[model samples]
Target: MPLYYYYFGVLNATLLFRTARWRPPLLSRHAARGCGHAPSYGKMAARALVQYVVLRGDLRREPLSWPLGALVAQACHAALAVTHAHYQHPDTAAYLDQGGSMRTVVLEAPDESALTTLAETLQQNSIDHKMWIEQPENIATCIVLRPYPKEEVHHHLKKFKLLK
Candidate 1:
């Protein structure tokens, strides 16, 4: 026998699915609703993982006119570093398993101070991340949080805007 609880809105849908006690029932209902049958239970882990990258916007102006690609490289470095550091963790493994579906949200920070402040906040909250410091020149470029279920970290990032 299975239990069913119905609630409207996206948050309710997530709550209904994420409760460990009710996960399988949600999966069955998901397929019944034509979400397409998942080949394995792992495929039904609908947590929606994400890695957030915050790059310093000052790099784009005045004294330093780094091209867009160069700034992007900073984000890439941080993301790869953090992912590698946490490769053995469950969420990280699930994110990598997502392959083509992996999601990364890049946002712009005002300057070094802002990036540093945000890093401190994450540290205080026990959120692990990699803050990439450009070598040779040795400048803090960007920070990347290891893959996490969006809801776990979205509130900390709500203030940032997507990088344009």
Candidate 2:
């Protein structure tokens, strides 16, 4: 009933019909004149149908990591700062996520360069994971780690008489 069925029937006839074999075989010749041999009409039609069906409803779009340059920049900045702090600490190492956020990699590096290297390592890993980086500040500073912890943040605020 489908158009494909008709193509398949014609293909079967060309391949198996007794009279067609005896005839000039123009259809077969046309199908085989080039490309070494022509593929079966049925197969070609089926392939085309499959391609059409598979592509249906599919809309190509840019991948998320296309804007990674922004993330890279943020990661670099945070990494630099974290590395600075981490350099002061003899124990804990610092790292930036591929998404360009900082986190403490405890029991890790002993200095700034090591922490920066760790951040770089995380950036590379983020590239491998195909994630886009975003700033936590966009949501709120609560999410961003200032150069100091809450207590330190408060201590600095006290200088401005902002902290009670």
Candidate 3:
């Protein structure tokens, strides 16, 4: 003969039984509360993981007529500089940890004035960024914001459109 006790609600009402060759199975209280069911972010990570790259659209317009590739290179430069500058940041690490799937939104500003104005707005809001100045030319051609959760900075960038 064996004695067995059971509880309902895992912790409340109780019942006792005595039966030969019968036993209560072991169970953990914490396990029943879904302790091991936290959401897993493997492969497809969470959203809002992006960096914003803004380049002057005028480079490809008017008499300047810079090559399309040249403008792309400027954006790349800013992206590299900003990422390097903030490599130790948690958001930056998460962004890069995405490996080949790293995300960046390339936006276009109409001209240097537009770029400068956006820079001012970002500065006013205390957002960290790098305004890339090309050497010899000494021009503010592109800007890159440190990797951030999109929701944190999207409003400031929403007015701009994709570079291409």
Each model's C-alpha lDDT? 0.78, 0.28, 0.75
TM-score for every candidate vs. truth?
0.72, 0.20, 0.71
Give the top-scoring candidate (TM-score). Answer: 1
Considering every candidate listed, which one attains the maximal lDDT?
1
On lDDT, the stronger of 1 and 3 is: 1
With a 3 Å backbone cut-off (N, CA, C), the pairs that clash in candidate 1 are none
- lDDT by residue (1-164, candidate 2, tens digit) is 42223454444333343453432233345335442333344443332210000010101123323243443344445444544544333111111111123232212122234333433543554311111123553311001122333232232122221101
Q: Give the least accurate 10-residue stretch of model 1, judged by summed lDDT.
A: 35-44
The per-residue C-alpha lDDT of model 1 at residue 111 equals 87
Between prediction 2 and prediction 3, the one with superior lDDT is: 3
- Local distance difference test, candidate 1: 0.78
Question: Which pairs of residues have clashing backbones in candidate 3?
Answer: none
Best to worst by lDDT, what's the order? 1, 3, 2
Comparing candidate 2 with candidate 3, which one achieves the higher TM-score? 3
- RMSD of each predicted structure: 12.0, 25.6, 16.8
Q: Residue 21 in model 2: shift from native, Å?
A: 88
List runs of model 2 lying over 4 Å from the truth.
1-66, 92-164
Question: Number of clashes in model 3?
Answer: 0
